[model samples]
Target: MRKNRNLIVLNIIVILGALVMVFPFLWAFITSISPGAGLSSTPQLIPDNPSLSAYVQLFDRLPFGKIVLNSLGLAVLTTGFQLITSSLAAYVFSRMPFRGRNVVFAVYLATMMLPMQVLVVPLFVEMKTLGLIDSYLGVLLPSIASAFGVFLLRQAMNSVPTELDQAATLDGAGHFRIFGLIVLPLVRPALATLTVFSFLNSWNSFLWPLIILRTPEMKTLPVALAGLQGQFTTQWDVVMAGSVISILPMLALYIFTQKYIIQGVAGTGLK
Candidate 1:
């Protein structure tokens, strides 16, 4: 009886904790669809009368679609670039024997712990010199090569059995062909997780874009969302609508790739 009671209490505590964590998202979601007026005084989470006016005004007041497209474009392009660069680097480090490979890999992984903010000013000056400011390439450049991705893929690649690579090589396969045909297929789960994470990070990046993009046309989702705030009183409902718009894609991507994400982590080091 004591154990049963203790379990019940613990479950209740966990449920309450989850609700506490989820409360902000629930509020943001509810408030987005709510009309702007009387939002502050609403005694309940769900509006007395739900409306889509906030979402309507969000796009009508700004180029919401353009910002969404820009964000999506950057996310997709950056993810692709990182996947290729990191995977190749990881494969080389894990499989190919070369001089000073451990030393180089150690240096590379150490660099990942360094914050990108330290590099932003120099990156900005370089972009300006190259006339890349306010351009998509400028937004995508700093994120193209990722050390986190490299570390992750290196660990994943190392787990892949050496037998597969040897068999491929025996059949007259080159390194590139072997990677493309055998190693990549074996690490599909890791690639899917990496792709989803890289895409979300790119989509949500705000500070760099705000500093790099001067024109309204070049602004991505988070920057454009920040623009919803002004010198005067902010539009709470519209801001919330924009917030939902930005987060929904990430949620959808996570949902779709959740299996791969968990499986990738679970499968690590079994070989």
Candidate 2:
């Protein structure tokens, strides 16, 4: 009976936590439908007359579709490139032993300690020198390789048993074949986890895109959304509408990869 009571309490706590996390998205959705509502106005769980005027205004006033496409394109490219580069590097670090490999990897991992803020000026100068300013390539070049992704995938790869690689070798499988057929399949959960993280990072990127993209048409969703705010009187409803829209892709991606994410976290020994 006591165990049953404990389970009930745990369930209640979980439900309450879920609600707390969900409240902001719920409020954003509500505010998006509440036309002309400002953040200063009293909070209304349910507005008197909910309409999509804010979304309508957003689309009419801004090139929201193009902005969303730009974000999606950049995010997809960044995630794909990161996955490829990180996976290859992870494989090398985990399987291929070489002189000074550990030292090199340590140095690479140390780059993660340096925040993007510190790299911005140097990256901008480099982009300018390369004449890639205001181009998609400039925005993309910096994000193609991710130290975090390499670390995560390398951890996952290390967890794979080396016996399998040896057996594949006995079967006349080359390093390329073994890596492709054996290791890659086993670490799928980690790959999915990396994919989600890479996509999220690229999607929400503001600083780099803000600095590189000069034309309004080239601006991604986050940068474009920032333009909506006025100096004195901001439109809360429209801002909320954009926020809701920006969230849908990420929410969908998470929902689709939820199982893999859990498995990946557990497999990697991460809390």
Candidate 3:
């Protein structure tokens, strides 16, 4: 009976926590639909007169479709490149035997500690030298290799049994063949988690794109959303609408791959 009471109390606390977490998003959506809704001290979850006027006005004021397409393209390309590069690097770090392997991996892991701000000037200079400044490549080149992704994937790969590799070797399979046919399939959950993470990071990235992309056409959603704020006055409803639209892809992606993310994260152990 004591255990049951504790469980009930825990359940109630969890339910309330869930509500608290969801309330802000609910308020944002309500504000988006409530035409001319200003920032309120007490936010309403339900608008008395809900409408899509803010959403309509948002598109009218900004080329949101093109911006969305640009963000989507950059995100897709960044995730694709990171997946390839991270998987190959992770495979090497986890599976290969070499002198100074541990030291090299440690050095690579240390790079993740460096803040991106510190590298911006040097990266920009390199892009300028290559004439990639103000282009998608400029925004993308730095993101193609992800240290976090490598660490996560390497951890996942470590969980895979070496016996499988030996069996594949006995079957005359090379390292590349084992990687493609044996290892990748075993780490599908980790790959899915990485894909979601890479997509989210690329989609929401602001500073790098702001520095690298010069034209309005190349602007990403976050930078474009920031533009909605005026020097003097801002439209809260329109900003809220843009916020709603911006979160949709991430929400959909999280809902689809949340299981994999949970599984992958739980299974991975730092080695």
Candidate 4:
């Protein structure tokens, strides 16, 4: 009876937390589906007419399909690159022998403490000097060397049993082959976690893309969404529509990855 009561309380708390977290998305959702321009007056929880006008207008005003493709491409590229670079770095830091490896790893980990804004100016100047200011490569370059991913993957790799590495090496496999066949498969959940993180970070990137992408064709969804906030007025309904679409991909990705992401953390076993 006491356990049942605790479970009931926990359920209530969870439900309340869910509602609190979903409030903004719910508000934006209702606003997007509502027919008229403004959602301020007597905004019911559900849409009155429930028209798709805002979403239609959102696409009409912007090339949404193109933007979605651009966002997907950028996110996939960034996530893919981060997985390779970070995993290699993690593998080397975890298992490989090298002079000053610990110190180098320390420096790499230390980079995570530096907020990205501190390096933005230098990065921007570097891109400008390379004539890549408005290019996709320019937007992606800064994010490729992900310190957080390296740290996370390194910790995950550390948790892996070294016996597996020895077994692979005994099979006449090279260090790279051992990593590819043994370590990577074992840490798939961790990779999934990092993949989702990298994808979301790249997809929702605003300030860097804003500075780098000058042209409409080059603009990402987040930067394009920023234009909805006009100088004198804001287009709430249409902006919300764009926002909903922008977030949908991330939501879907998260849903797919949540189990693996959870398992990944639990796999660390230091909890």
Candidate 5:
């Protein structure tokens, strides 16, 4: 009976926590459907007469389609490149032995500690020197590789039994064959997790894209949505509408990959 009561209390707490986390998104959606809603308006769980005029105005004011495409393209490219690079690097770190390998990987992992803000100036200058400023390539080149991806994949790869590699080697299989046929197939969950994370990072990326993509047509969703605000006045409805739209892809992706995310994190021994 005591245990049952504790479980009930825990269930109630979990429900309350979920509501707390979901309230902001619920309010955003309500505001998005509430025409003429502003920042100063009273919060309402349900609008009196909900309309999608804010959504209509969102597209009218911004090149939203192009912005969405830009974000989507960058995110896809970033995820793809990061997967390839990080996987290859992780395989090397996990399977291959070399002098100073651990030191090199440690240094690489340490780079993750340096915030993007610190690297922004140097990256911008490098982009400028390469004549890549205001170009998608400039935005993409910096995110093509991720240290966290490398670490996560490496950990997953490390957990794989080495006897498989040895057995494949005895069968005259090369490193590439072993990687593709044996190891890669086993780490699908980690790959999915990385894909989701990389896509999310690139999709919500604001600073680098904002700096590299100067033209209005090249702006990503986050930066373009940010422009909805004026210096002194802001339209909450249209902004909320844009926010809701921006969140849909990520929400859908998480829903789809929720199982893989949990499994991947668990498999990797990550907290």
Candidate 6:
């Protein structure tokens, strides 16, 4: 009877926590469908009259399709480049033998500690020097290589048995051949995790794109969403609608790769 009581209490607690977490998304969805709704001190959980007018008006008010395409293009390129660069760098760190390798990797790892704010000015200057300002390449330049991605993938690679690489080497297999045909297939969960992370970071990026992109046509989703807010008056409903639309792609990706995320995270520490 005591155990049953404890289980009931635990279940109730979990249910309450879940509700608290889901409330904001529920409110956003409700607000998106309630046209002309302003943010309230006490937000209404349910709308009296729900309408899709805000969603319609969202596309009408802005060139959101262009913005979305820009974001998608940038994100896809950034994620792809990160995966390739990070995997190569990680393989070197994990498998290659050289002088000062640990020191070099340590320096690389230290970079992840530095916030993006510190690099913005120098990156902007470099972009300006290359005449890449106001271009997608300018926005993409910094994200192509990721320290966190390298660290994650290196840790994953370390968990793989060195015997496999040794056997491949004895068989006259090159590093590229072994990496492509052997190691990569084994660490798929880690790659999936990195893919999700890289995509999310690029998709939700606001500051860099805002600083680099000057034209309306080049604006990404977050920047375009920011435009929905007025200096003195804001449209809560349309903004909420935009929020919903922006999250759909990410949500879908996560749903499909959810299993890998857990496995990757848990396995990364095993090395």
Residue 72's lDDT in candidate 4: 93
> Per-residue CA lDDT of candidate 1, range 1-271, in tens?
9999999999999999999998877788788777764346553575777888999998898888988999999999999999999999989999899999999989988987778788889999999999999888898998998888887788888889999889989999999998999899988888988899799889889888988999987789988888888787787888888888888888899999999988777766422
lDDT (0 to 1) per candidate: 0.86, 0.96, 0.93, 0.88, 0.95, 0.93
List candidate 6 segments past 4 Å from native: 1-7
Per-prediction TM-score, please?
Answer: 0.91, 0.98, 0.97, 0.95, 0.98, 0.95
Q: In model 2, what are the clashing residue pairs, if there are any?
A: none
Would you list the clashing residue pairs of candidate 3?
A: none
Better of 2 and 3 by TM-score: 2
- Pairwise TM-score winner, candidates 1 and 4: 4
Q: After superposition, how far is residue 65 of candidate 1 from its true place, in Å?
A: 0.7
User: What lDDT is reached at residue 27 by model 5?
Assistant: 87
Ranking by lDDT: 2, 5, 6, 3, 4, 1
TM-score-based ranking, best first? 5, 2, 3, 6, 4, 1
Model 5 agreement with the true structure over 226-255: per-residue lDDT tens digits: 999989888889999999999999999999
Better of 5 and 6 by TM-score: 5
- What ranges in model 3 sit over 4 Å off? none
Let me know the TM-score candidate 2 reaches against the reference structure. Answer: 0.98
| Ten contiguous residues with the weakest lDDT in model 1 | 37-46
